[model samples]
Target: MRCETRLYNALNDRMRRSHGVAASQYEFLRYLRDHPDTRVGDLAAFFAIGVGATSKGMDRLEGRGLVRRVPDPADRRSSLLELTDTGTQLVHEADETFGAIGALIQTALDPARLHDAAQTLRQLLTALEHDRIGTPAG
Candidate 1:
């Protein structure tokens, strides 16, 4: 937990300083970029966050002109989200920022060790998600 927190803080601080985006917001934006027209509820479910909180976050992004919400034709009560051109561009640049971090890590640590750690983390995440498949989300 300590290592995770440190990594998160460092990464988020760098991302925000370099691109005006926090790590959490970047994750949300990247998801929207890949899944255009996704509903706020669907995003909440995917991220295991509250729908209300997700909607509020979306509102902020909309206010910043990085995203826009449109009425869902099939479901009038719900809105579908799409990334604006600026959001798309930011995501593209953020990819490079993330890649640069990976490069820095590889330079500081053995690339083979980093790959092994990444693979182990992936396996752990998969198992964790699989275990929660039939469980209720907070």
Candidate 2:
């Protein structure tokens, strides 16, 4: 828990300083970039955040011109999110920032140990997702 908190704080701080984006926002943008035309509900589910919070976050991103929502053709009530040119540029910058931060962190760890730890964390995350442990209930 302590390690997770420290890492989260460090990453968030670095992202804020380097990209002018909070860690959550960076994460949202990253996912959106990878999965274009995703729905708000899908994003909320992916992030394990509430629908309302996801909507507000999208609103903020939209207001900043980082994200744009187009009416979903099949679902008129919902919209599909897509990154704008500015958003794409921001995501690229954030990627660079994250790479630098990751390098800094890796420098302090043994390569083998870091790899092992990352593998373990990935397994855990996969298990959690498979079991829907943190997913919100309908």
Candidate 3:
């Protein structure tokens, strides 16, 4: 757990230093890039995080001019998110960084072990999902 935490902390720090964004912010940007007009609530769901946390991440991205929160045409009170040009660039950069990390991970493990770990983690997550830990509020 400490190793995982350290890895993520380093990843986040590196991302912020190099790209001026956190992985969560990059994820939100990626989601918006792919989905174009997704709502904040939907983005929260996609990330499996609370709406407030997603909103806070979005606020940071918005401040960086990487994302825009426009009124949803279907719902006046709801905001639809989209990636700006700067966001597209940042997302691409993050993808490269992630790709490098992925390569490193892949090289560190045997193929069968990696596959087994992935399957085990997926099963664990499925079980946990049923138990519903840390469910978000409306």
Candidate 4:
């Protein structure tokens, strides 16, 4: 958890300095870039956040002209998200900044140790996804 917090803080600081966008905002933009026309409810589910919170974030993104919401064709009550040209450019910049940060971190670690660590983390994630651990007992 501490490691996760540290990484999140570092990414947030870098994103603010380089892109003028908060890390959370960048995340939302990135998702929109990849999944154009996605619904707010889908985003909320993907992020494990509430619909209200997701809507609020979308509001901020819309205010910045980074994202636009169109009435969903299939669901009139909800909107589909799409990234603007400026938002797409910002996502590219954010990707570069993230790559640089990743390279900086990689330089400080031994390749073999880093590979092992990555493998272990992947295993842990897979186990969690499969509900191999942390499920409440009946």
Error of 3 at 102 (Å): 0.9
lDDT of 3 by residue, 7-126 (tens): 677678777888877766766787888897898888877667888888888888888899888888998888888888888888988888766666766888899998998899899888
Question: Backbone clash tally for model 1?
Answer: 0
Q: Give per-model TM-scores.
A: 0.86, 0.93, 0.85, 0.84
| Ranking 1 against 2 by TM-score, winner | 2
Give candidate 4 regions above 4 Å deviation: 129-138
Candidate 4 clashes between residue pairs 3 or more apart in a chain or in different chains:
none
Candidate 3: clashing residue pairs, number: 0
Highest-lDDT candidate: 2
Which residue pairs show collisions in model 1? none
Top model by TM-score, which number?
A: 2
| Model 2, span 1-138: residue lDDT tens | 997788778889989998888989999999999997799999999998889899999999999999999999988998999999999999998898778767877998899999998899999999999999989874
Encode model 1's per-residue lDDT on 1-138: one tens digit a residue. Answer: 997787778779888999998888888999999997899888887887888888899999899999999999998997899999999999899988777767767887797898898999999878877776633454
Give the clashing residue pairs of candidate 2, or none: none
The lDDT, on a scale of 0 to 1, for candidate 4 is: 0.85
Q: For model 3, what is the error of residue 65's alpha carbon versus the real structure, in angstroms, after optimal superposition?
A: 0.5
Ranking, lDDT, top scorer first:
2, 1, 4, 3
